[model samples]
Target: MPTDHPAPSPRPRGWLSRFDTLRVKLFLAIAGANVVLVMTAYLIYSWSFDKGLVEYLNKADENRLQPMIVRLAEGYRQNGNWAWITEDRQRWQDLSREVLGTGRMPRRPGELAPTPPAQTPSDAQPHNPSPQAPPAGAPPSGPPAPNVPPTFTIDPRLLLLDPQRNLLAGPEGRTEQAVLKAIVVNEQVVGYLGYVPRLQMVASLERVFLAQQTRTFAAIALGMLAAVLLNAALIARWLSRRLRVLGDGTAAVAQGDYSVRLPTRGHDELAQLAEAFNHMATSLQAAQQARQQWIADIAHELRTPLATLRAEIEALQDGIRQPDTANLDSLAQEVSRLTRLVEDLRLLSLSDLGALDYRFAPLDLGRFVGHHLNDAASLSGTPLHVRTELEQGVEVRADGDRLDQVLNNLLQNTLRYSASPATLQVEVRRHDTEAQLTWEDTAPGVPPAALPRLTERLYRVDESRASASGGSGLGLAIAHAIIEGHGGRMQASASPLGGLRWDIWLPLNPEPANA
Candidate 1:
């Protein structure tokens, strides 16, 4: 034989997988986009700076280099060796030393551009004299024309080399990677202008601007990352906590506890869900209580009649009671009580399942209640005072058989539950679009709270008395069901006769029953 076992449930996933969740993913997406935007903006700013700096540096270098190139060639031509340039060492020292006075550097033409400088520093002395500059006793240079861009300086570290690569004049060493400009006299190449650029050209003070911009961008990226992570954590924690609570509540309810309640704060969809859960819990609890009550009441109702029937049969078998009509009638009555209980239960089950059958038609309500009261007044075979205040021409659409049964149940209740010498009043009248009927009887009425719950199945104001009277506690409940099935309303209220009142309201144009 194979033994069956339930399948094991899957284990919960680990928290690290939370990174794959929508909240974390969305936050990271936004953060990544912000970082990309910041980087793009920084790149654009850097490009613009380089472009402007190159243009400015190009103009300045042109101003400084044009006259110097011609002078270098003239010196080489006259001395035939570089004696005119090398003999003047003090000017060479001034040229290199003034590089420090202003925080700017020279650039190789057609290569990396030099950084732009502010106006020429005041402490600056002339290095390479322009052709326009006055020689000894010569006329001083005239002021530049208006609307012209100011002049510039060039300070490229240079070497001169002949065709055989012989060092002629410049710093006395070979430059590893210097661009060469050919020096020409009589349109013939003689020596080369070997130019080496200065080291780390941008000024030290200007480095601060670049550094600050870099720091600002880095800070923004880090701050945005931190914010995204924090927001993701908060959102994930909130969703998981609420879901866990809901899971726990459901587990408790599954174990037959319906009293669990969840917090319903905030004006969000989650709060609405909490409210609906609470409502479901309350309904479940009420249903459980009703089921327990129905079981106990049914058991009690069956036991009394069964016990009576058994005792009677035992007495007849023992010959203690003769087989006469009176003793037989008692047994039949007990059997009748048991049968009534079973029938009532069957009808209730049918009504509860919405399977009860009905045949609907228009009826004169005033005449129906009048005839019902007269029949009730004569049923007891005892003379009793009955009052009537029935309005004529009161009509309604309903299931006539069901309505009759409801009225009969109410009349039986008055006879069984009320004190003797009670006066019963029947009335019918129109109230809005409905026809209202009332049965008010004399003393020993139901309590105020009991009246409201009287129509609940198996609910009885006096359980002991109801049980002794062979009531299964379903009379009023069945009557209420009948009335409701006919698309009408019924209620128990305080009567003017110092007794219970049964009020019925039936819509004049009630919907027909389903076929």
Candidate 2:
């Protein structure tokens, strides 16, 4: 018993592989590079732009708050009274609370009070609360030791400063390093003050930054996409122009005008391909001329012999050469020759029409080869050494009858053309979802010049030998058709034994019906 393992399946292609065309690949590559470059530029611009904007806003804010602090200090000094300072402080604090959002300032227990707003410090405002006095015998609160204002409200935006650098009563204990200008009056500082606008303008700054970033990124993305599309369009236009030229050239060649040439003076791959195409056209034109000449020569050769045979037969029928075996045999032979030529012409016509029938089924390749080997050995009369090296139980979906025709033609060609005592080697191998079969002979293969046209009907390597050897020159052509009809391919090349090698490739997975 043999193993019944199925053949491997073909690998499924990914989405990327589906766009394997050169045009699609090139366009996608261009677009991808453009997107990466645009995104990188946008990120760099936004980072630097936001930093500079923040610095400028901070500086302008400090200038605006400077004057307000100086005015409060002057009124307290001129009056020499803490009452005016208290009144001023209350007014400023209230204004600040309205400007910057109001929230309870952090305080010790009992520090917050329900006391009426301070008026004149001398109006029995009861000196300083014991809790307010830091035991340093700090001067009575109000104007800063005669010159500095007792208390003053600085801009909340100026909150970014170290406590040691604060020259005005900063809202609370909050401090930041952005505070650039600190205020000082007389020798002693009345209260800490400085302006770092980030404290007050951060919300506005964040909103602006966000909006800028969004706009910048969005613009870059869209701009990049537009640039890519434009570039692709230009590239496509140029490529399309070149391709159109090539298409026109191909059409001309198809119409039998083989004098087509493409412009190929660039360092691009397209130029190289164009040059190569022109070379191919030149070669084909030369080959066509040779083919036309060969056909004329063959027609002349065929006509002379046919005319002579017909005349002799007519004369013989009229009792010219007594209808003997020699004369009748000669007549019969000529008819046979004419019949073979007509059959060859018919095979070529069918191949051109692409008409071939195929009936497919799962076949045991080893058994198929063995059966054919028996027939070939029996018919050839010479004991053919059949060598079969195949993976056991390998099955293929193919047309068995068509395959039999293909094998018979190949074997017949081998027995007729190959040297005596020839051996037939059949090998069946599984490769992915395809099965490859190779048949080799022990005689010299056809010449290299004839290799390409071996499957062409009536195309014999030696026309002289074709007549003498009784070859119709259509066997290999028919074989090629049968293999192709079964969704397979057949090719002839040099064999391992220095003879002809006919290799056939068939799909193990049968194509679906109607596919």
Candidate 3:
């Protein structure tokens, strides 16, 4: 019977994926900037308009009334004739008429308009009929009122002054007009004028100004939007190029190629990111190579014993050989080989995980060297020859067992690889706060290329020889880890014996060294 299961849910999108569209982000940013810019611009425009409008109206008022008053005063001062005087009155009447017209004409196209004065003749005649009349209506008005002056033909509907401010000597009538006052000179009220301009005219101009402002704001907004989109595209393109490189590198690494490198050309954050990525790639490549080499070394090490065991068992099954001591020993050797491999793997794991514990103690260099020298001589089945170039009683402090393991590994390694009856040398010296131990063997030296990789795990110069000599391929690795764990430095160099030279460094203070 089949079991029921719920349908699999789709993966949810992250915030960066859902809301990070480049174009949309750019648009929103541009929009926010424009809002602030336009608000500030609008306030400036409104203030300017208010200030300019008031100044404009003041100039208009001065031009209209001040020039007329000046002319009347001058004419009266020059000549007392009513004709000269009346002529000035006619001009003032014309000014009032023009102001009441549909629009204020700007000085008749080419004329440089004049200004008004503060004082004028008070004896000027009235623009309307006399109120007293001549004795019981007296022949229906004196001299026909002189045909009422052509300047007065303008419509009264647009008159600037209301009835209360009116100075005209005429019959009473009701009409609505702007508030105005006439200047008094020599006891005569003449020349009406408005201080605050007509609201209708001001409102009309304001509407047009507002429309211009809107157009200007829109144009600026459009320009900013275009600039934002262009910048976003350029940035996104650059980022995408780097991302593509990273993706390709990832794919190459996945396919077991660790030699790929990323470009580091720019000084931007992306370049730093690329640098970090390249470093990671390089490290991974090294790790992968080491792992592969480890597997191959293990296989090669185990294959011989396995093949021998298989051959011996097969021979016995076919009755070609008896179950004798020789066959049992062969099987036991195979088991021992497998056990050694497992132990090396375990030790490496502990070292890598920083779980290897040590018991530290004071150690004497002279005594330690003598003991190990004798031990290596016996194990290699060759005469131990020691050439010492050192000062005695150089004492250092560290874990004795771990340090001995490091020395033993190097000693055994030299003996196994070096020719038999080789001479061994041990030297001890002190420099500043640190002590050094050097060991060399009189055997054929390693090649220049192999020297640098000698400390690498499972790396060997002669793999076939390593198997015949029963080496587990982890001796140098263990030595490296032990010395490093003790806060010391271990390095290999060319020896005067024409073989490998190993050096171990330990601080006399026994404190951990800075990496």
Candidate 4:
């Protein structure tokens, strides 16, 4: 014999398996939105901050270069030409360093030391030609004191250009995209000082500052993202918990447990759903109770006649009672009562299922009521006093046969339940858009509480008396159903005539336009 073995369960695929639940889906949706927003803000802030910082640096550089332009202009005025410093490259380098207050440039290996300029008349007293005595409180000024070292250094890229655009001094190959300042002397353009604009921050302090700010921004972005994800997770968890409760409740109902109810705490859609679910459960519970009661009532109703028939047959078989005419008549009556009860139940079943046939036609409401009352009184041979208050020409759309059945059931109930020599009153009239009919009888009244339930199937006020009088208890129920099928409603109330009252309302038939 082969050995039996269990197969292994399939494994879940990767990390995505954890995201299959509603909680994960909700969390991901919220977290994804937060991430996109945070990232976009970070990128935008970085771009704007970088551009603004560059513009700020460029403006500061322009302001600092203003004094340098003015000093160059003064030097040009004193020399009256550019040859004094241009011919001696060493002199030009010294002037540049002294004017801008920058550190001295380092010399390359094997490079000759720069020679001092020769004694030329133009070079004797450059940049200062004002030969006046110093005023009191004014510091002695021969050459202007060098400005404190600038925050930034640009000595290597700074250059002097003559009026014709020829490079006079400073580094070569850096004139492209250079910022230029005009050297104006005596309202005439003399030369230009230019420096290449910085493409990125090169100063150690500036680089450190930018890097620190960038790190701060990134940290803030990350902190915000983390907080948003936490909040998203909390919200998703809360929602999923509520949904799980709903799912459990629904499953309980499916399993025929109609008592499950969910908490309706908030005014959200979920709360509304819970309320609706509770309502459905309550209705199903009532329907289930009603179904049980209906089965019990049917069994009880059938057993009475069945037990009587069985006892009578057993008596005749044992010869304890002869099958004489009187005995046979009693059995026949029991059978008739049983047949009537079964037929009534069948009719009620058909009506409940909306399977009752109806042929609607316009009938005079007052005339119809009068005709039924006369037939019932004459045929029943009851000594009850009958009265009719009929409003002529009150027409309603109804099925004639069903309308007759409703009237006969009401008359029969009156005859069976009311005391002999009691008054039976019938009234028909038009009230607004409806045709209203009221049928009331005198004495042996039903209890107020039982009045509302009179039209319920197999309901009887005096069960023993109703049974003795051969009442099937389905007459009113069937009558109510037929009236409803004919687009009418029947209501039972405490009769002013001291018995039960039945009120029927039907829509009035519309008059023909040509009429």
How far residue 492's Cα lies from its native spot in candidate 4, in Å, is 3.3
Q: TM per model?
A: 0.63, 0.48, 0.61, 0.73
- Cα lDDT tens digits, model 1, 99-183, are 3233222322464322222224773567866563332111123431233211222343556677666765566565565557777
User: Model 1: what TM-score?
Assistant: 0.63
Off by over 4 Å in 1: 1-218, 263-268, 510-515
Which model scores highest in lDDT?
A: 4
Index of the highest-TM-score prediction: 4
lDDT of 4 at 255: 99
Estimate the Cα RMSD of every predicted model relative to the unseen true structure: 12.6, 15.2, 10.3, 6.9
lDDT of 3 by residue, 1-515 (tens): 99999999765478756656544565456556655675677668766765776566545555655544454344444443223323234333444433333222223446432322232568454667657432210112222133232332222322223225553321234323333445444666544433444333444445566568658766875676666566656665666677778788889878978889988887888788889888988999888877887788778777877898889889999999999998888889888888877787787889999999988777776677777777766676666577877666677777888888887888778778877677888888887877898989877888888987787777788876876778887889888888888888888889998888988888775543331
TM-score of 4: 0.73
**Residues 262-316, candidate 2, lDDT per residue (tens digit)?**
8886878989889998999999998898689658755855785599697887888
Per-model C-alpha lDDT, please? 0.70, 0.66, 0.65, 0.82
- Candidate 3 vs 4: which has more lDDT: 4
Lowest-scoring 10 consecutive residues by lDDT in candidate 4? Answer: 133-142
lDDT by residue (1-515, candidate 4, tens digit) is: 99989989776688967878899999999999989999999999988887788788778778777877876777677557776567757556655665555633444458654433344775355566667543211123344345455456666668889887788887887776777888888888888899877677656566677899899999999999999999999999999999999999999999999988889988999999999999999999988887898898889889999999999999999999999999999999899989988988988889989998888888898998888777777788879898889999998888899889888888888888889888999899899999999999999898888988899887788777866777878899999999888778899898888998889999998874234
Model 2, residue 380: distance off in Å is 5.6
lDDT of 4 at 494: 87
The alpha-carbon deviation from the true structure for residue 178 of candidate 4, after best TM-score superposition, in angstroms, is 7.6
